[model samples]
Target: MIKTKTLFTKLFLSYSMIIFLSFTLFGLVFIYIFHLNLYDDYEELYDFHYERLQEQIAQSAEEGWSDEETADLIQPSLHHRNYNIFIYDNTGELFIQPEGDAEYEPDQEIILTASDEFVSEGATMNGNLSYIIADSFSVPGNEETYVAVMVFHDLNHQYQQMALMVLIPFIITIAFSGGIIYFISQKITAPLRHMNEAALQLATGDFSRRVTVSSRDEIGQLGDTFNYMAEELNSLEKMRKEFIANVSHDLRSPLTSMKGFIVALLDGTIPENKRDHYYLLMKEETERVIQLVNDTLDMSRLEAGQIEIAPAPYNLTRQLQRIAVLLEPQLERKGVGIQLEPEDTDLFVVADKDRIEQALVNLLHNALQFSLNGETIRIQLETTGDMLAVHVQDEGKGIPEAQLKHIWERFYKGEKSRTGKGGTGIGLSIVKSIMELHKTEITVKSKLGQGTVFTFQLPLKK
Candidate 1:
């Protein structure tokens, strides 16, 4: 199998071929037009000379000069660089021969009785292609006594000279054009080549590689997009490594605690009275482990599109009130009051009720964990146009501005100390995924040391 050519090579070859063919065609046309023009000028020259010779013959005949005088009179006018002149009498005899040694004998019968005023024909003489022109003139003294002049013009030398003159410039033009075209093609494809190299590096797990943009054209835009993708992949690679480390740490901590508690109870390290307490501690650690595993599985399923949303009409306000009542014990323990500020009208929305409830639980739990004692957690529902917006506001230490953007990413915890606050760091990610499944977006507005508000909109049932 033959290997294919590179893009640069193909472009250069195609451009060069086009230039070469164009120059070849133009040269052919130029040569053809030059040939025609040369012939026209040659015929005109012969006609002019023939007319001058006739005037000279009329003058000689009017003055009654002899044949020798007439020949001398017309000789100067008959001389030409590219043509040989012969004059024939009415009796088909040569009257004036050319001044130099002739290569072939002139045809007297053809020259004298030629019918046309200007007759041009091709003849082979002395192994070369030659052009012959014949014209007749009547002497002023006698109308019947006429003289016919034949001009033999050799064309092989002129054609050879013209070919040489046209071919040299044509070759030079093709060479110059090919060089310029190659340079331009290289400039055009340079970005694509860099992008190809960067893509290869990325495929090999080197996400740091990037392409340099040199133009504002489509190829440059492609290079920019490639660089952006590489940056994203690099960020994702870092996140993946961090995720693995976080998972390992979270898993190991719970397993190690449970292992220690079990060993202490089994080996009599703890007093008999404390065994029950240690067992309870082990059970709590095991529960934490189970929660982590469940959250991880939920996130995986959501991201893999394995979870389907079943939407239906449900009362938005009643759902929030119910979640608050259910979490009344936890909220009471923390001294955090639940405030439900819903619209007075029965606000119904079309969404997956179970998924929305899960999202609300996550957000409410997050608020409860962060709220200070005696602070109020507000669950507000407001109607805006055809959408019903829900807001979960916590009067707790707010998230920093820098960490706000990454709050919805899996395993991204803004407060490291909140790891023990009953969260697997997958709650917000789950909520975000659920909201996205409903074709809506979750938004957060927070400032450090103030409070955080989590808002999402749902379509109101018409």
Candidate 2:
């Protein structure tokens, strides 16, 4: 597998490269434009000087002045400026050459090619690189013409300054852009970094760690989700510990009872005539242990999606009546009566009949555990729209409002004091899992000191 760069490095490099390329292209274009403008100004300045000299020569030619007098009129200005001025007659012969150690020879072909417009060409003058601008002009009131050629040495200095003007600001802007991009990238990734750390802590079983939500953007929403997940994991961890402790206690209590009874019988502590009574008690304890193990296994299979439900059309009323009959022994033992209220017509529901019956048994068992003697537990079935609603309501001391939401959780017993209520504490969880598998929901409405109702809806057979 190939290693990749960190998010911070990637973000910084990506943003920085974008800014750098943009500024660099802008700088190249800016320098090109600036250089063109400078070149235009230099051309205009040289053109003005060339025109002045042409006007002087024309005026002098109209007056019929000698070449020496014309040089005297133009030489002073030529010396003041940084150019080597050369003048030629119409025949392409050298007319005037500026006083310098530089040697020159004027070419007739070059002079004839020159026009009123300035033409620039490279040349070597006095052993240095030089640029020459040449043009031709006609004398006023005279048919004679002359060509003017001006040579400038080292003209690149102005272009160098123009490049510097473009480059300096570009460098400064790029540096400033780099700083801003780094800050922005950090601001964007800071929340993610915190979430990464929180994730690591969570992986290490630190469910209590939560991320800080600093903004109301997507990252902030992610942080909120992460915190919510951590809270759920923390709750689940607590419930897992409680489940293990409960299971151990439930297993050990029955084994300890069975052990004591067996030992008493084996050592003849109880008389042979009374052995039958102790044998029954030991059998009940063994059954209790078996019941706990079966409930635990069933819950695990249900949660692991291992239980395959066979859905078929079944009479809802008959299923409820059968469950009530099955639990009648315990109900009668507690002096509790079950009231069945089915709809007038036979209510057929499409569901896994066995699983639905199991769910009803769990719900009724829970109600029985909380109900008082002679209190009637109502099993009501009603039709709402196209769905059938089954409610198992108990007239027991109702569950507290705070604990109502947690009752469906595995191993969540509402009353810790009633720990020996003949349950594995996972009955309601199994009920909830069954209902969910049927693509429905179960709801409970309870008021403290009032009655509690556990209602679930199932689809009618199509």
Every candidate's CA RMSD: 4.3, 4.2
* CA lDDT of each prediction against the hidden true structure: 0.81, 0.81
Please give the lDDT score at residue 328 for candidate 2.
82
lDDT string, candidate 2, 227-317, tens digits: 9999999988888888888889889998999999989988889998999988888887888788788789989998899998778998888
Model 2 misplaced stretches (Cα beyond 4 Å): 1-4, 77-85, 88-93, 101-133, 140-146, 150-152, 170-194, 211-221, 259-310, 343-345, 417-425
Q: Whose TM-score is greatest here?
A: 2
TM-score of 1: 0.80
lDDT per residue (tens digit) for residues 1-462 in model 1: 422388888888889888888888988998999878877887887777778778778888789889998888877655566677777776667777667736645565566556335567777777877777777778666664555555555678888888988899988888888889979998988888888888999999999898888788888788888888999889777767767777778789989998888788778899998788888778768876786787788899999999999999988888877888889978988899998885356789999998899899989988988988999999888889999888899988888788889889876756554334434567899999999999999999997777999999999999
Query: What lDDT, from 0 to 1, does candidate 1 have?
Result: 0.81
The deviation in Å at residue 214 for candidate 1 is 5.0
**Can you give the lDDT of residue 346 in candidate 2?**
80
